[model samples]
Target chain A: MYEFLTGPMVWISFGIFFIGLIVRGVRYIRGLDWKLDRVTYGENISYGVRGAVRSILFWLFPYGTRSWRKNPWFTLWVFLMHFGILITPIFLLGHNILLKEKLGISLWTLPEAVADTMTVVVIVSVVFLILRRIALPEVRIITNWYDYVLLLIAVSPFLTGFLAYHRVADYYFWLMAHIISGHVLLIAVPLTKLSHFLLFFMTRAQLGMDYGIKRGGMKSKGMAW
Target chain B: MPEGTLCNKKTIDTKEQLQALLADKSGKEYYEQMNDLDVDRKALWGVIQKSLKSRTKTWLEICSHCGLCAESCFYYLANNRDPKQVPSYKIQETLGKLIARKADVDNAFMQKCMDWAYSKCTCCTRCGVYCPFGIDTGIMFSYLRGLLYGQGFVPWEMKIGSGMHRIFRAQMDITTEDWVDTCEWMAEEYEEDWPGLEIPVDKENADIIYTVNAREPKHYPEDIAEAAILFHVAGENWTVPSEGWEETSLAMFAGDWEAAKMQVESVYDAMDRLKPERMVVTECGHAYRATVIEGPYWAGLKTGKTPIDSLHYVEWVAEALRTGKLKIDPSKKIKEPVTYQDSCNYIRNGGLADVAREIMSYIAEDFREMTPNREHNFCCGGGGGLNGIGRYREQRNIGMKVKRDQILGTGAKLVIAPCHNCWDAIRDLEEVYKIGIRWSFLKPLLINMLEVPEHLKPKEE
Candidate 1:
């Protein structure tokens, strides 16, 4: 079970994620017809690039604009949650060791203490996100079964891995569960809302291009971009 | 509810009267218009398939349903934060569902979707600014509107207006004779001030061909007179086309691309014949957008080969002021505290907010800026052809409460809206809310403050 989880399953999930993203990205790029005459918010390419960069930087931080201020708790937790999820996968010691053992290449690793704390934060943030979906009426209306299922999928790997690392249950069973769930997540990223991780840049680029390039050199006002 | 005290009794009565005028249509007429279109799901799906470009696809996929865009919408903010009013929900309930179901939605669902797309959203694009990913809800809504329009689900006013433009070459069914007569009458009215002012019509090879909204002839002839006065004083070689004088494009608002193309082509054909070096559009927000920005694209003209240069009246006025051709009398400036409502098309879409404010500063003694002025300012709620659709009057009035509150907070006596639709929407708000404030078009205000030179002023007898 351990060999299958780390060998063919890992390759399968990685193949699905990387190839799926490439297909989606290529389709999106090929579909674009440059709207040379579309009216934009800015006057020139520099203005568009500036607005795009500003938008990216603003959204990268929590409470970046007044809109984000509406739900301060959600903003902070979600930001931290996303940060941990993204960073821990690449930098966690266990993941790096697996990479070194398998592929003979490994990135820098985070200390076990830091990795444990990040996994805990990710688990907590996922719980909060689920609570937010259930608690807020506006959010509740839009939430579907897929949303809850996706959240469960996102949280399982972190939860199981943390328990396994701390030896809270049978270590082999918990570790296997973690590896399988982690593969499920990798497969889900390109196929679900996790696609936002990649598509967000595309959305921001289109907006920046609109506000910056097509707008005839006018600077976007107060987050208008 | 806002914390402001209500205005005097006179203001309340005025508000009621204006609301009555807007909502005075018969129930029979509403029903008649509602049942005009037959729903064909397959045809509608085809329209959606054709309209799904990269931008729409990206916007649809990337939205995380975070509900962050809710606060950016005036409808959402003003209506006690209703989630249904959220821009994302509009996409989800209509286009999102359609995409999920492969555009196989039922007629009842399509009807509800059409109402949401047309009446619920103004397509102001303001919400996009606040979006974390800057997803343009306006573009998505427009694509939905285009789908509905292709299936013959357009509102009555838009259909009638587009029909008028297609048949008579104008909005509001103004005949060629009526247009010529109105121009002559406006020229005569302005001649009283300048004695020999020439409101030239159909003059070939003129420096500029000025076009106006049909409302200027039907309801607000004074706007035309003001433009004439400004043009006469500036000594511009401009002429109003006899054939394609009305510049407002209801077809564009209706999402009927073919009719929109025809409307634009009429102007292009006129410019082609007249050979004007430039086309100066009057102070109608949608007209300026459809003409200067979207006209060539819709009319199938090549990217860099537009027949004539299109300029908004705001740009023209600003340029005139800059070049000393039109001067503002600083002493004769408007004394009352004034605020400018940046029309969505002029500011958010056209990026002329700075030029508009600059022009306002030169004419008004005390220009009080609204809390969220310029591109970030709240829409007047009458854009996207909402003001023209009688069925959405109540929704429009309710949606405009945010703008009403913004104006009330400024404590300004007069509001200068640069676009006709903004002027109309703000006027309705002033009346509906009993705010007791007056509204004027920016052109008349500029005309009132403009200084005629000794050589141009009428000689005292």
Candidate 2:
């Protein structure tokens, strides 16, 4: 009975998610008269490759020795948590199973322990993010309806997953709820502001390389072979 | 090899001089200079109000304010950690108020919001990066400034700055004759550095047409000389248009988008007339960014085609170095601790700080880093025409405290600023705060440090 209910819920959510995303995506695509095209246009391949690699590195261990040394505490925390949990674990990894599980195909067993701990980290990080957004007067001043929606979006799956892990409801129902919510998030990724996952790394690397050259800091050592 | 000492003689020292300087210069008796541009205040304000009206709905509709923007802002972290000076707050003080009043409150309050908005922000769009919404307040502010500009209520400094821009499409009110004479002076100076290296003016069909801000000729002549030397070494064919070569657009800074658009048109006009394959913008960050990126989209409605892929001088030089067209001796830059100030227009707005650093490393031996770098770098308080308006004095200084701390924190003996406004404003802070740090353009440092080969060097007497 739980499986039946779960199955249709998944299908319904997927349908709504796909349709909503397609509407938004098509709107954005059609909206490109010229200016949008200009921004989208660039040295696409160089930017695309650079963007993918650093984004993955950035999400994992964000405060990894270098960033923490460079940034202020709050900034580092916000940077790591926002990118690490909300963005990386959920948004970038695409329900955490798409890329991570695929890439770790041989090491699938390793993810169980990592996954449970990461789920906890996501909840804690989201809590920090929520409190920081509310606590900081500057952040609060700029917060809008979308921000609240995003914050809820980031927190819900983790909470549902945690509940599922603990079997808060009948085991299958909770897992089904988690799976449905997770997939909906996957469909929403490219259409919403969540797409920064796709955009930020390229912007940062381009910025990093551009600044590096302009200030005469270092040439593109062309990355380690 | 820091070139210019931060002139210790502060411009407006006492409160009295500050008052005199800030006072309406035109109001002085017998001091009638130019005809007052009897700008229509009400109609202009209406345009501004209309612009605000359009933006308010969007402003309220966007900006999640994740505080990633704060990390991206140099101003926030610089001023003893004051969050209000964050790019968003600088935006909010004006646009936020307008949004609240226009949608929720009253028109009179909206009028007050317009005043606050016009006076406070510089419209440098560095914070657009951290904005998950990509709500470019710079665009919003620039739009508002354009509206305010149409009305005579634009801050006085921007009025003069944009007025100059209107006249010459440059920062200063220079003429064709002055530009020729200035280039001649640079050519003659470069002769000492690279003899017979002529900075061709209005030379048609040159492969590259290098455009410079009027500031290089008007205030810092050496900057022009540095460019000439670089061109000489690179062996690239480049020319400057005698009439429309200037690329710095204060109108862009001041929010006079029409005037800003006109400036872009003039550069494109120069390109059309000169028919250069490409244009290498001089070492002015905003000027370069404006000519290539923002100027096009913000004003591209007027121009039929996207202008050629104009590159920043830093990018050009780094490429030249990479291609071995231009060579440098790293030891030429003294071993003294030196830090680079990323102009917000370039780093945040243009996303070119890494290129700037790449260029600097080849010249300097010891380099110190600014705390928040690249896209996350702070504004030098001079961006967005803040320095242009004399009325914004105290606020500009307070805002500059962020940059002041960044430079001071580096404890570097020298700071390299690529943009003219950053150069002027940061130099002002060094003097005002008595931070005792010397500053110069990146090229000047390179020129001083680099060993121009005897054959490349100008022939000795």
Candidate 3:
């Protein structure tokens, strides 16, 4: 079970993630026709393309947009949550060692203490988001039972990884659970709302172009206001 | 239930009875059968499959429900931060889930969606300004409206308004002959004040073809006279197309694309026949949006430009003031503490925010700005054809609280609203809230302030 969880299972998860995202992207392009959807699909790379690049880059940073600026605490947690979850996987010492051993590839790895702390940060941030979902009427109204389930799906890998590293409640069992959760997270990315990781760029870019070219928004000339 | 009359809590008896109410030449208010209406799942899914393009489908898939769009909406703010008013929640609950659970929703569910889409939102796109992903759920709500419209759950006013456009080629019942007559009458009435002033119709090869809102001819003939007076003072070689003179599209508000397309094509046909160098639309926000920005897409014009270049009324008025085509009389300039309403359609959507400021500079001595003015300003709450709808009047009233506060914060005695919808919105706000503020359009102000060219004056006695 452990061998399957860490070996072919990893390849299967990555395969689905990559192939599913490419299919989603190509499908997005096929749905749009320039004449019907107008300038977003047009050849005006001048304003539309520039706006698309700027907007995608702009919203990625902390305090990047007006919306981000308005909710400072939420912004901090979101960035922290994203930074911890996304970066920890790539740079964790154990993951790096596994990658080097299996695929003859490795990047700089974080120290054990730092990796454990980052995993804690991801766990804490997920808790904050869940509490925010419950306490904030605005967030809670749109949230469904499945929203909480998605959150569980997101945080389970980090939680299980922390448990496995701490050698708590049967080390081998936790290690197996962590590997399975990681694979599940990877496989769920393109199939569910976790697709936001891929879609954020696509949506922000399209919206920027839509606003820039059609509504004379964002970086349009003489847009003093 | 459909175009003719509202189902105001009364059960409708028969289709003939509903058609009888619809027979009122002007749209009349009467309850029609809405008791346990059945959802046409086939038709609903048909529209979803055919029209739910990549942009909306992507937005539906990708909106993370972060709730950051709450404060960005005036409806949410005005309703004491009601969680339900949040743009993300509104769109997702109404349309988003519909897509997620397509063809499974019943009539009760769809009707609830229709109310939320029409009444709760103005489709202002202001929330998108704050959305981290720029997911304009307003666009989705519009799609939801199209879906609901297919299900025949539209608001009575919108249904009738689109019908008016379909039947009369205007939101009002006034015919083309009536519009032309009103223009001619206004020209004759104002002729003594400025001799030889005429609302020239169907003039070939004119430099600018001016289009106007039907509400002007239907109610305020003085507005037509005012535009003519301004054009005469500026020496603009402009003509009004007799056939496609009406520019505002309640059809656009109604989500009736066919009627909207038909209405736009009439004006486009005018541009073709008259061959004007430019088309100048009146001081109506949605009219400018419908004809210039969105209309081209509906018309499928490849250039994404109107056949002729088009300018909102403010853009033309600003240029006329800036280039010394028409000078503001310094003595006659407004001395009151005046603030300008940044209409969403023309200012945010149209990108004429600076043009409005330029106009204000030329005319007002004490001009105040709404905090977070121009593109980021709150909507007038009466846009998206909400002002005319009989149902949802209470929600409309509640929604204006934000605008009321914005104006009150400015402490300006008069508010200069350059668009027709803005004009109507603030006017209604004053009537209800008794804000003790006067609202106006640029035409009347320009007429009062312009230094009329000496040669064109009525040759003094």
In order, the TM-score of chain B in each prediction is 0.91, 0.82, 0.94
Comparing 2 and 3 on lDDT, the stronger one = 3
iRMSD per model? 3.6, 8.0, 2.8
Give the range of the ten consecutive residues with the poorest summed lDDT in model 2 chain B: B1-10
How do the residues B65-164 of candidate 2 rate in per-residue lDDT, one tens digit apiece? 6665665554565555566656666666665664444434333443444455544456655555444344556656666565444433344455556656
| lDDT tens readout by residue for model 2, A7-125 | 56557665765666566445443433333222322333444345334433443344532333344565455564564354334332234454354344321233455656666666776
Select the stronger candidate by TM-score from 2 and 3.
3
lDDT of 3 at B270: 93
Model 2 clash number: 35
Off by over 4 Å in 2: A1-18, A36-134, A140-225, B1-65, B86-126, B131-140, B147-153, B185-197, B233-236, B298-309, B319-332, B348-351, B450-461
* Residues B1-461, model 1: lDDT tens digits: 11112110111123333233225353344344344444556765676666676677777776777777777888888889998888888888888888778777665676787788877898898888778777888777876777776654556566556656666666676777888898899888778678778778899999989999988899888778888888888989999898878778887777766777777788888898899989899988999877766776676654422478778888898889889889988888999899988888868877788788778767888899997887788888898999988778888989999998899888897998878898989888877888899998777777777887887778888
Give the candidate order by descending DockQ.
Answer: 3, 1, 2
lDDT of each: 0.77, 0.61, 0.82
Query: Cα lDDT for residue A129, model 3?
Result: 90
Q: Per-residue lDDT for B137-173 in model 3, tens only?
A: 7777776776776666777777767767777778777
* Ordered list by TM-score, greatest first: 3, 1, 2
